[model samples]
Target: MSTAELRYANQFEIIRSEEKDRYLISQLSQQLDELYTKLFGLNNFHIYQPYLHRLSELLYYLTTTLSNRQTIGEEYVCLIQYDPITKRIPSLMRRLFMIFFRIFGDLISKYFLTTFLIRPIAEDFFHPKLSLQTIELITRFIITSIERTHKISFYLTGYYYNISKILTRIRYLIYSRSTSESIEIQSNMNKTIKLLSLCLCIQHIIETYTSLKQVALSISQHRNQLNLIAEEEKEKEKKIVSEDITSSTDYVRCPLCYELAISNVALVPECGHVFCWQCIHTWVAENQTCPLCKTNTTQSRIVHLINY
Candidate 1:
């Protein structure tokens, strides 16, 4: 095989190893966090929840920077960081910088920026206002974009799984062994990643559509409410000018059934209209308004009057 092909193969193996290690670390951190919360109680865990990223990053840093030891993933893949400049393993100072850089940078990007910067700005000045779903959709899109970009870069350069790796000028060197095992593992991982990506793409599209539909519905409801208010005002003026013909001359009669309001007399509390109990009940169930005055009402508002 050509030198370039060998280098690409090594880099691909390194990427896969790093990703697998990340998954393991995440699972470990979640288990530890759950155990901690269980031990300390849920209420106390709420206070400690904000520092979850810190805990995970600290664990990652410690594992990756142990004295004279490659990270677990690196060892698994028979890989080590080599400095081309010195033709040897990376210097201690450089390794420390890389560790701190990855940890702090992730914390800032994932937590601090979103909490302090993006959310506040979005809440205050976004035109038409943004809903929680819209914000979540935006966040998901941003994450998907970053992952796709990283995948493209990995395919093109086969150098860095993480931006921190590039920033620290780190390169992988295989130890005294063939990379056949790592290559096989990576191939499987790649297939799984592609399937996951497809699922995420479908989810993103669905969420985007849902958010937009919600926004449209909100706008439509607002407009309908305003128009209804205007129409109600006009109706009120007309109702006051003309008395209800059915109840004008007969107060002890139900307008709905045109019968004496003697059996189960029901009162419309809002407009002082009277009807049979069954009549008003059925009217309110269907119309949800006073038959005479057109006032808004409900079944609960239809009070039954006692013949005292």
Candidate 2:
């Protein structure tokens, strides 16, 4: 087989292994549902009991969807049943729960999987059998994945909090603007205006929140695709490094210069490749050439470096 084909095969194997690891971690997180149920039962008596039950149902549905061939449409139907408009309570509560479900789904898939599943697999990939250079490359890939996931979560959480805050503010606005007039007509007008303001707020909140969420989700999805490609590349590098370590090759090649390592002096980039400073400085001066790929560097850009 061709070298590229061999590399591709190794990467596919790695991805499959990572997927299995993620599935196991997801199973473990499911165990937390019982604890969440107990806590809800103890602290939240009546109103939140239904919400807790719904959460459990959602979790069960998700597990089944992941583990087996079960369709989640039925579970979605169960969720929709929670949509009820009662007398005094705001109808917006139903909308709130819908948004909550979406947010929860995102968290379970992204943050929960990354933290519990991918992390351990990544750590294993960097263990003692791996050389320093291979370990550094894998570590850099893992860290980038983590930071991207974190930023996405932060944006999502902030969006929800902002929605909740807007709701609270609308409630306050209505309450504050309410006047107690003995006249029925005036009271009716005030009530109408209050309701109108609330409706407007709800509309604005939903529109703005949806727009922000779409942007964040799009960015996250794109980054995830890039990460998958990066993961495949890293796996290929790992195999090459492993082969080099076992071979009778004498001089350690400077990744930047692609020549014999002259100096014990090596500089590590934020991306974790170590090379002779001379090679690195020359590459940096020209533009950032990733010691390995000669990929253009943005180390001089403060914001890019800090954000990365």
Candidate 3:
């Protein structure tokens, strides 16, 4: 291979390795980045802080729909310019509103947005210009997001390794103690140490999350197997059940209650268990299986048996 090809191969390998060890590297990278930040007085990187806002933008939507407020982009601006500027909503009330908004958002995005809106629109006009535009937008957005995450991850990692080299070059200044170091200097060191501790906690939490996710997946599999086993057992029981022998040759009787099916409606369930309408309905409502075979059955699976 040429030099350029070899370089590209190495780059690809690095990318693949980084992706594989992304989570593991993040903790080290974060701590090192913070350490470098403290040593060199780097600006604290703050992006998308969710805690400062008591209420979300959903409040703006509510205001627009309920109180005829303008659909202003900014939440703070919307709140201030409103007629109720003098009135102050309680902290508890704001929290309650936030909770309600979260629930409503989940429900709407799950059912209404996906089922009613997105599904219909996509199904109807999937091959049209709208879909093309949507696809392009989504593709571009995804590419951009991936690029940003990659850049940040690498930058942090670089900081972690690069800081040592930088520190080694500037060690003279760091080691040289001229006078009493300011309280702020001590505070910065403390903060840096605390941040490194936090990074450790974050890594542990991530590992725990991965472990818990595996456990949850295993539990889900077991639950599904249990359901399947229950279904099979129900089927076996349904097969073992003796057909109800009645006094007359013309009519079949329900095994349960041991009586001739007097009702006009005859119930033949999916398990081939013959029963009276009311009897099967009652039985299924309780047991959800054929009385004889223990086979799985439901109200929907029950059919009417007609004799000529």
Candidate 4:
């Protein structure tokens, strides 16, 4: 061999020797085999069972090949030990299968799991016994929560982006500006206040978003309970309406603000309290607590009545 080739061969042999001496590879192979078996057994009913089987077969082939290889110095052991023509095709097929599996796994776990499955499962688990009216209320609450989260996310993202841009501009200005006393003082003060305001804004947004998300999750989790309470409430309401049918100028008292109103009304759930839409909306916006018993009003929405 030429001098350069000899040097390359020596380095390759060193790498091979180091790798062979390490027990980590053997341990990893054993662990992988166990994992493959467990996964295969569990995933027999999966739609991608064939693909999984192919992956397991490929893994076994690779593991066996690696185990049988002799760590000879400076010699490149042929990775493919079977017939060149037949083995080549299976090897290529295995490679393609592995590539596709990895791509699909990444896409499903990264995007589909969070976006489609988890949220829906949570919603369904919480809202099992829902009537049409209750469903509408829950839907409105969820939509509002999601919209609020999105708005907060967008606002924070913009704020950070602007702050980063401003910092970059400030850095450039500092490096290029002449060192005058007045300029130095002004720049320092501007940067300090800018950074402080940015930090405060980010902190406030994060806290608000976290609070909203927790409230949404709580509402989602208790959807079944909420539905039951709503049903009980509707029954009580029917009785009240029957009793008030004979009165010409009957008005339901506003449960939240205690303001007497004739229009745009909503029913406070569980407690069977009646209130105007504007009163409930303002109360929910401020305290998120029932005016009577301090029950949560986080998921409450305005219900408009249609007079037939």
Candidate 5:
């Protein structure tokens, strides 16, 4: 074999069939990992739950807005995700209504007290038991106390009360708008990435399958050749007639083991000569050069040993 052919054979000499299959399997695993990471990263159920909650909140706001019959008065229409109602309401207005109603109910008591400061005092004055200055002072004190109590009760509960302030509400709204838009954009991007990953993963599977198929076919052919050689060897043993006559089998025995190994397999380095399978396999494992010829083996002619 020329230097170029020898170099070419060396490529196959190092990576036997088994190692190549392992390489393909490992590479397929890597492609699978890349595909999974792209498809499922943070875009899965863990993050979807928040959006579900947001949708529920939005639904509640729409329902409440449409039910305000006093304001809508049977002359309005609302359409939310195909659910049609005869009420006109926008998303922003619904958000405001929800913020107020959702927060106020939790913080304040659920009672409409009819008792007023003037009711008890009026009865006292009617009986001439109170002076005008005393009533005036008492009324102012009661009004002040009611206002303080309402504010203090709301703060003590710690039930999302921070948004009640004007600046906080504005900040909350801005944050919510940006966050919603970002979530939507991220969700879209995740979908696109997942689609692309699926395509690549399928392509990788096809390629890996092709590689494995070729390897399997090669292995099958090699086994068939070994079987045929074994049958021939058995026949030769059965007919040991002319001991002096030369035969083709005499040339194929391994110089190392000096006996016919499985298939009487042989390797032909660049020298265009043959050596036993055991001999050449070991020789090549240690060194690429042919033992006798000291040249790169030419695979073009060395491949067929069942006939040799």
Candidate 6:
């Protein structure tokens, strides 16, 4: 097989193996949760829910150790982990560290800390000096950058699928299985797969860029809102301007929005006052009265003045 074909097969297998690993973890977690619920009754499951992450991690640790393998999924997929330097299984210490790091470093930092610690504190502080959400966005952006870098590297070199593997100095190698045979992908199919991978990479890049843009917008808006003095001054100025405008009849502004140009202009039947149709409709939904004159009115009686 050609180099492209080999790389394609390896990428496919690696993704499949990783997916299998996730499936196994999910199934084990669900089964354990179910067992606990059945044993302790439904009402008591809430007590166990908080410790689910710890339990799952423990289960993973025990499973890996007892099975004498890196992971059940990798073994199932005829894949084995090896230290690139020694061309042998990683040492006990290294393996243990990798497992612990997966459990503590990735799981705890990403899920546990965010859920248990950061989230509650963030909720308590309505306007924090340093926003935890901004911190989270930065953290996520860093992780995404690393993952995208790893993905590009994987595409080019067909090496590590998991970032954790790269961090732990581990790589996957296919083990011999009599029943399983590596299929030779046709040149056309290989090209198609490459094209699809490129498309996916492009999509991922677009999504990341969009997320970054949204986060930037949100942070800017949050900062603006946090400026109490500026916000108060703006509000006071707005109130003064609005009072002056409303006091004068010369200004052809909609009372609802205080805008010079009224969009979809609608007249209140009882008050003979005009407003933006949307503004009036929204206003009448809660209070069925003209905003400016306080004359009784209904949404149905509001007339849209098209040419008038």
- TM-score of every model versus the real structure: 0.47, 0.20, 0.21, 0.20, 0.21, 0.57
In model 1, where is the ten-residue run with the lowest total lDDT?
Answer: 1-10
lDDT of 1 at 213: 72
Off by over 4 Å in 4: 1-118, 121-125, 128-176, 198-210, 213-226, 229-308
- Clash pairs detected, candidate 1: none
Local distance difference test values of all predictions, in order: 0.69, 0.44, 0.45, 0.47, 0.44, 0.70
Give the per-residue lDDT of model 6 (tens digit) for 1-308.
21221122266667777787778777778888888888887886877774775577668756784346667667667677778889777777777666676666654556755666545655675344546677577457656766786786776566777665676787777743322123334344457667866876887889789878976776776677678767899999999998886667434567768775333688888878888788889999899888887888898999998854
Best by TM-score: 6
Q: What does candidate 4's lDDT look like per residue over 1-308, in tens digits?
A: 11211111111223344354234445544565567667665544455545545455345434443344322221232122222234222343443343344324433443554356545654666444433443444444444454455434433332211121222221100112234664577567556656655776676667667766665665655675677788999999998897676354345756556555566667666565667777777777888876677777664443555441
Shift of residue 273 alpha carbon in model 6, Å: 55
- lDDT per residue for candidate 2 within 40-86, as digits (tens), equals 64455555645555565456545543333222332322211111224
Residue range 1-308, candidate 3, lDDT tens digits: 11211111112223333343334334444555565557755444343222212123334335542353322321212222111222432233343343354325333334454446544665674422233334333334333443344344433332211121222221100112223454356456556655655675566556556655654464455556667878999988776663332334334556777767654355655556677788888888888888878888887788866651
Clashes of each: 0, 1, 7, 0, 6, 0
Candidate number that wins on TM-score, 4 or 6:
6
> Could you give me the TM-score of model 6 versus the true structure?
0.57
- What TM-score would candidate 5 get against the native? 0.21
Q: Give the TM-score of candidate 3.
A: 0.21
lDDT of 6: 0.70
Task: Write the number of the candidate with greater lDDT, choosing between 2 and 6.
Answer: 6
Worst 10 residues of 4 by lDDT: 167-176
